[model samples]
Target: MTGSPLLALPGAVVGEGLDAGVAAHYGNPMVEQRRLEQGRAFVDLSHRGVLTVTGPDRLTWLNSMASQALDRLAPGEGAEALFLDASGHVEHAVHFVDDGGRTWLVVERDEAAPLAAWLDRMRFMLRVEVADVTAEVAVVGVMADPSALPAPHAADAIVWHDPWSAASPRGYQYARDPQHPASAWNWTELVVPRAWLSELADAVRSGRAEVAGVLALEALRIAAWRPRFATEVDDKTLPHELDWLRSAVDLHKGCYRGQETVAKVMNLGRPPRRLVMLHLDGSDTVLPVAGDPVVGEKVRPEPAPGEATERRVVGRITSAAMHHELGPIALAVVKRAVPATIELIVESHGIDVAAAQVEIVPADAGAAVEVPRLPRLGVRP
Candidate 1:
């Protein structure tokens, strides 16, 4: 993991493990989170990966392989796409934007190499060229508005504004909440030269702009019901389970790798699992981390003896955070059979913490289209 120049600032605490080499916070996390919420701060995501694809065949080639319709994506417009395996499981969640000549793909830190290799293999006879430029550029994240950054830096930066709030014409939304939290999630990522990181650090130090840590950014993302590939996805995860079809999967687009399963789930079957926001019990002062088991009681039928009910694992927490206002919250993916009305217990550090379910993906999250039944031969109209 390459270190960011901002880590040299006073009170900057570097993150550990997977978030190594990045500042987790700068002395005061609460204040930083508030600044971020108000669009007054920027997050140093230089640790994330950046890839660039350039060629005349770039748009058409990517559109044929990606779940999103990218063939007609105009320059400066940003979109999300999913690269799924043959079995319809999500392999990658890509955020990309084109600047006419070049297309930039901003992905999770660990995905850069693998994605580049895969794209290179798929190039075949196409003119597209894939290069992992993670070391050449840094990814800076801004919320609400991106124009708050300093003048010269913002002028030459390539920005990828998130399109999660809007409905895709070729996609379908499974989460039917009238007031979805994502409507306020105006997130954007800017690609800037790595050497310019010091300028951003100076801005933070001089009060020209504020800076927030990854923790603050993640808390707000979970609150917004945003699905990040790194945290929310696993081997068996499907896009419908996270309501990702709303932004990443194009239902009406031409066939891709997992189009059969995507179509079947959307038109005839429901996803096996569903995503839910967990409002955790903060009394224990313990927030369950990612991969924590979510358990619930279930009735066992035809028990051998006196066993009438037992506790069973129903789901697992994908991401958890301590929000500045919302207290402790998490996003979990649970079995579709898990009743939304039931209170779940999160097993965190051998302690059971109560979690109330806030429905994100409904139990019946697929089979969206209504199919008409044919009349029998002898039946009247």
Candidate 2:
């Protein structure tokens, strides 16, 4: 895809890779981040993919395939859902809202095509009509209530207020913290006609509204401990691993593609891994990138006569950013056995950056039910 029209604005610097064709920053990132968090600025996320599912069976068809309870979702109400593979690995993270006639889905650019194809194939006898409208529609982001924004919309102007801040009904929170960082997270996305991209740029240029870029938006997301599909998911990721069950999974909902594994893990097992917020030692000028190895010392049986221990890779950094308020921070998915209090090392650019772990998903997450243990071997009488 070509760069968004917003890239023509002054100070716009194009991003790379997944963020390609979008502005990564606009001259000053920290200033933009502050204004954005204050709800005084908006971001151009026109680079994201948009999909629309219309028809009478749209809600029910989607409910049967996603993690959330979507069948009864009210018009204008925003929700998050996950599309999982049979084994319960997250395949797509979706943010959607219905505007009476059509359900608008906002997803990462890379997942858009594949997700649409998969949904299309599942349309057997359903009344739903799926269409990838990425080239026809655009998304705008803001950290404010939708009522006040004059974002351009098509026939159905839908605003998706993120539900990550609070636990969804029929959902479970794996993070033990009584006050999760997301409690203060207020994010919303506006679905508008692609042609209005110029109007939005005009608003920014005229100072009717301020503008921020991907870097600014990302910094706030990291500080809020929000898990994004493109950044946090891997081939082995279970929603439980990132505490995503609090918002994206309905524990008692009807069966879906990966419900069996979701049920088993919640009822009788633990997630093999857990998510944590890492406070990186900012003394080193370099920030770790995604996939950087997170190493920590662990005790193991010695090959010789004595016991030995060595630093081993326990996990990898899923995302990292420099927050306007928090210094250098990151989110990492590590083994369930990694101690919550351990200080780990993020190996990046041939340098080891020290990081202190703050637990997001506790080590004991899952196994929601209390089952009685039977006698071990023949020891019990």
Which numbered prediction scores highest in lDDT against the true structure? 1
Residue 155 deviation, candidate 1, in Å?
1.5
Worst 10 residues of 2 by lDDT: 147-156
Candidate 2, clashing residue pairs?
A: none
For all predicted structures, in order, the TM-scores are 0.94, 0.94
* Model 2 lDDT at residue 248: 93
List where candidate 1 sits over 4 angstroms from the true fold. Answer: 299-309, 372-381
The digit string of per-residue lDDT tens for model 1 on 5-27 reads 89998889997655677898998
Candidate 2 regions exceeding 4 Å error are: 147-156, 299-309, 376-381
What is the Cα-based TM-score of model 1?
Answer: 0.94
Global lDDT of each candidate: 0.89, 0.87
Q: 142, model 2: CA deviation in Å?
A: 0.5
Worst 10 residues of 1 by lDDT: 299-308
